[model samples]
Target: MSQLVSLNLPAGTTVPSHADVVIVGGGIMGTSIAFHLAEAGVRNIVLVERAELGTGSSAKPLGGVRATFSDPANIILGQRSLRSFEDFNYRFKTDIGLRKVGYLFLCRSEAEMLDCERSTHIQNGLGSNSRMIAPTEAVEINPFLRKEALVGASFSPDDGFAEPEKVVQAYAEAAVALGVRILEHTEVMDVASADGCIRSVTTNRGTIQTNAVICCAGAWSQRIGEMVDVHLPVTPVRRQIGMTPQLSTPMPTVPFTLDLSTTMYFHNYANGMLLGISNSNQEPGFSRDFSHEWLPEFNAAARICAPALVEPELAQGWAGLYENTPDHNALIGASKTVEGFYYATGFSGHGFLQGPAVGELIRDLYLSRESFLDHSSFSADRFTEATKLFREVHII
Candidate 1:
């Protein structure tokens, strides 16, 4: 048997001239799709990653996996993916370190609160037991929260966070056990298409002939799509996260909370708290530098939202890039312009939580299986000139 971690494909392997399906990214989304597809009896699947597994935005995530959302489609996807995370330990035979600390979305304005009210109604319609609570009740949920400044809040008791790296590795290992080939550090330099259909993909190593291909390359999916002459409206934005040392106060089962006005979010970690804020003025390039100016802004916001988390000792921080779209929604489903080619990327900042369900949806589409949830709303064709944009505001 060959090592699954790093696939050499044996001597004279011929680079697998063809596969039943070719996945162009080895992040959690790609690995999960390959895993689910193999589980569904699609064995001749190949996943190619230009770099290491989970090293992209997947690895740089804040590890917050929750079902709290403002959109029904996203709510459904989040709920399904959350279930996968809940049963991951026994089902995948690996610990995802899931903690159901809950998610508290702080509403700072009437508009935000009304938005929360509407979204909460849709969430309840989808069977999620989330509700809008007054600022006073917000303090009850987290005594550390500064309730006076908030107008109202939304809370989902069932949602929480998990270990991202472990989960991705689990998916990769299980997918391999089920016979899904993963080619690490394998750069897919070109995607070939002809007569309005995909023929194969040409990588640096060799040619991979396949009728079906999925672009899970996150921020780079836009570039990958261009290789096949398909235009994807995904753009990259910088997001920064920070960590604090052990505080004096006992961290109450703190749920992932968002300060709506400040665009700051913080959650409890094993040793301390992980915090971050979105950078709207980010340049169109990759830079992992932890901004010092953003620190004071985030701390000030965190202190106002949750006073107990405000501490002088800021331990460490890092930054990552998100593949944001115009409407802040992911581009899913088959490409309308390119035949035999599919896409499931451009998840913006919510890729980690949505990856599992997206994988399941991709599996159903490729294997001709019935999906547990309808995904037509997220189809890539939605970005066509004939279609309108769908947006999700509650991004952290």
Candidate 2:
């Protein structure tokens, strides 16, 4: 996957003198928010990025879009975004390569199976079509897995993966066409606020005098929030995905399957498969260089989940940052102290799937309108306590 070509965007001589709203970061979240705001007829929006668009996490070769979650708030967010992803080609005139093969969470324990059942109940209650299937049924959906190792699994047919780069390209192009200016290679230097309101946004190119600023900076959100004295508790953790070599055997089409206990996941990738394993001990940083340091552990997980994965010689596929919060949930809301400053970030590993819905939510947030879901629970204020806690926390 690659970034949105700079040639495709409107080349600007310099940063605009002013804008009604300045968006920091030009990844999927930022571009999606820009598109939604433009669709709402909001003008003079400027999206400033330090580098080319989609070079961040949004450029991942493939991203899973799902609405299956235990939390009611998250379920609705995913549901709304899933609808947007479904109508993307019609609404934005871009095919995102959306494959609704489904998402199957493989369970290996009774406790995990119970949680899957409970989450499925909540998902279905909130109009999210997710169900618990027996291990045999799961194997039918994804024949690569060993049926005997599973207790049961949660399956969501409405969920699947897509080319994230295309989605980002479409959003950025559409937003720009709607009069939104994108300032590429522009770094935000400082945010000037006074009297509990925003005065202007200072960048390397120039300052944008705006009343509102939205930090869609993803992993860099912590620093962006600090500019206005807003505490956005976001941490950047390096997440890597490995691409196995092309295999001689025909790879069967399968859902984006994940191991509930191990957090090991894999799905069809070209002639081989794409794989990722959640490393709990990975340090938080902006480092995104792919490495083979975790292969042993990943192979350990594959042994229990899918033994065949251990025999392949995998290449270092890609590395991206997962904007994580203390509880592994997102931080979305306005800053009480810095009145006009708001943030929509820290989705852990679920940002792309929920980007569209967050865009609508951020629009309502900036306009002071009632949103579809109660975003109070996702506030950054939850991290003020000494110990990390949230309404719901999931590792993957």
Question: Clash number for every model?
Answer: 0, 0
Question: For residues 83-141, what per-residue lDDT tens digits would candidate 2 score against the true structure?
Answer: 99999999889899998989999989999988988999999988878888998899888
The candidate 2 region of ten consecutive residues with least summed lDDT is 387-396
CA lDDT scores, all candidates in order? 0.81, 0.87
- Candidate 1 lDDT, tens digit per residue, 1-396? 113465545434546888878998888788888888888888688898887788777876357777777888899889989988988988978777888888999998999999989998999899999999999998888776887889999999998888778878888999888888888767898998988888898887789888889999988898999898787888877788777787687766678888888888888876677877774556766665667666666767777777766654567777777888888888888877778788888898888898889888988887667897777887766666544333333331
Q: What is the lDDT of candidate 1?
A: 0.81
Using lDDT as the measure, the top candidate is 2
lDDT of 1 at 51: 79
TM of each candidate vs. truth: 0.91, 0.93
- In model 1, state the lDDT of residue 151: 96
Displacement of the residue 164 alpha carbon in candidate 1, Å: 1.2
Q: Give the C-alpha lDDT of model 2.
A: 0.87
* Predicted structure 2: clash tally: 0
